[model samples]
Target: MDARYARNIPALTEEEWGVLRQKRVLVVGCGGLGGHLIDQLTRIGIGAIRAVDGDVFEPSNLNRQLLSKVSLLGISKAKTAAEHIHLVNPDIEAQCVEAFMTKDNVQALLADCDAVLDGLDNPESRKLLAAACASSNIPYIYGAISGWVAQAAISMPGDHLMELLYPEETVLGDKSVLSFTPALCAALQTSLCVKLLVGRPVNTGTIYYFDLLNQEFEIIPFNNR
Candidate 1:
């Protein structure tokens, strides 16, 4: 365990640790954002985690994906993420799924999760996850990054939320993502997940956008969501 995590454990009371331990989290896309999110979540004592990613780590991914390194090349993202989580805290339950997420498999993958983290790289998969969460009426924490910009939003079912807010085409823009952006976005997503689960104010119903180059951070108001 990291020294920082040991230092932070006292902040979590026995009841609080129990609450976090019992909660299950499903993390989709174990790439750049997913890697960081998994690390943070596990360090915070999240009990069970499901890591899903079909892609294999390549040399190109080493730049941003923490699980991708020279030695891990050719390994599946899910495998690397699962292994990393165990290294952080063997007490937590971790599962690695190296399959593409379709509408067919989405529900089962999401079945027992207390919450879903959308670390997916593409908008189509993101929308699919949102739809599943909507049908199940579970909270979905979403984060995406492109270039120096990142955006995050939380959608709860019955709001007709995600589709109403971010249209399919706009949300799923066919653009490449830069590495550093996902790292920052994933950190925020992890923090929001912990806060939401621990009865803390997560500032839900808002999309936060930050530009690393300009050092500007702004929140988009979506009170209706």
Candidate 2:
């Protein structure tokens, strides 16, 4: 076992840890949740990551984005994700797609990915990503964070999780987020993804909701459409 992943023992069996080193995942968006997702995925020894995001970092992101810094204010988030992942684990292949997730490019971005991580902040993009994942027959590990709340769910193929979660497409995104919110949500998402890729039992269509300010957590089970 590698020294860096030595702590993964007990929580992960040797076989499971080895499985992680062969799977590739696609992460959409590279800001708050996306940044932490890439960081954790790399450290835990994911074999490869396809990071997609066309946006550049700004001052507003300094508060929560792990890859954002004063000197990197105008840098591309997707490219930065690749750099950070390489720095964390040089063996991990971090592929950078410097483009937003759109109907035109979503399919190509998801190719050869074992799973898709939802690091997107908006509802419309999330819906598009879910649809793409469903079409590709890939598992979608969804995570979202707001001011004091976070939600994580796994959407298997043909599941209506996206439609049920985002019934209203016109819903505007909420920008209010605490520095710790994405970190917590990203951890939850990363764990779920690990379980998924390593053939562990994951409750598809079940949502894990957390309210940090109220110190409450709930497991909400829902039927898949």
Candidate 3:
């Protein structure tokens, strides 16, 4: 193991690190959650990462998006994320796809990935990605944030966990997201992703909720509807 990963010893065995070095993950959103997810994954030694996003950094993104900077204003989110990943860990292969994930392109984008991480803000887009991952038989790690609240879950193949968690009528639009919300949620998502990559037992089909306002965390079982 490299000295860079010295601190991760015991928590992550040598065998686990080897597994992470061969895993490929796709992060479908490069804003708040996406930035943090990519950052952690790169540091953890994920062999390959595909970052997908069509949006550009804006002034509003400065408050929460870790990859956003005044100098990077108007820069592509996916490109910025890939750049940051290379800066952090040049050994990891980072692929940037500057396109919005849609039903037509989801499968192709997620085709070769071992797992998909959902950092998308739109519930509809998340649903589409979840369906695509289910069809591809890949695990989808879902995370969302609004104000001081955030939720995360692992939607395994055929689980349809997002459909039950995010109903069809849910309006997917801008919400008051705090800076700490995505940071916390993204960290949790990365932890879950690492567990999956390391072949650790993860509690799939369970929604983990965090309420920062009250500093409370809860896990709710999710059964297919």
Top candidate by lDDT: 2
Q: Per-residue lDDT for 1-225 in model 2, tens only?
A: 779889999799999999999999999999999999999999999999999999999999999999999999899999999999988899999899998888999999999999999999888888899998999999999999889899899999897788887888456566699999999999999999999999999898999999999999999997743
Candidate 2: worst 10 consecutive residues by lDDT?
A: 166-175
TM-score of each: 0.90, 0.96, 0.97
* Alpha carbon deviation, residue 217, candidate 1 (Å): 0.8
Prediction 3 TM-score vs. true: 0.97
- CA deviation > 4 Å runs, candidate 2: 169-174
Overall lDDT per candidate, in order of appearance: 0.83, 0.92, 0.91
**Candidate 2 residue-wise lDDT at 40:** 93
Candidate 1 runs further than 4 Å off: 1-5, 9-14, 171-176, 223-225
Candidate 3 backbone collisions, by pair: none
Candidate 3 residue lDDT tens string, 57-99: 9999999999999999999999999999999999999999999
Alpha-carbon lDDT of model 2: 0.92
lDDT of 1 by residue, 1-225 (tens): 445456656676556666887899999999889998898888888989999998999887877887788988898999888999999889789999999899889999998898999878766787789889988878999898877888887777755546666675574443656778887898888878877887776776788899888999998877553
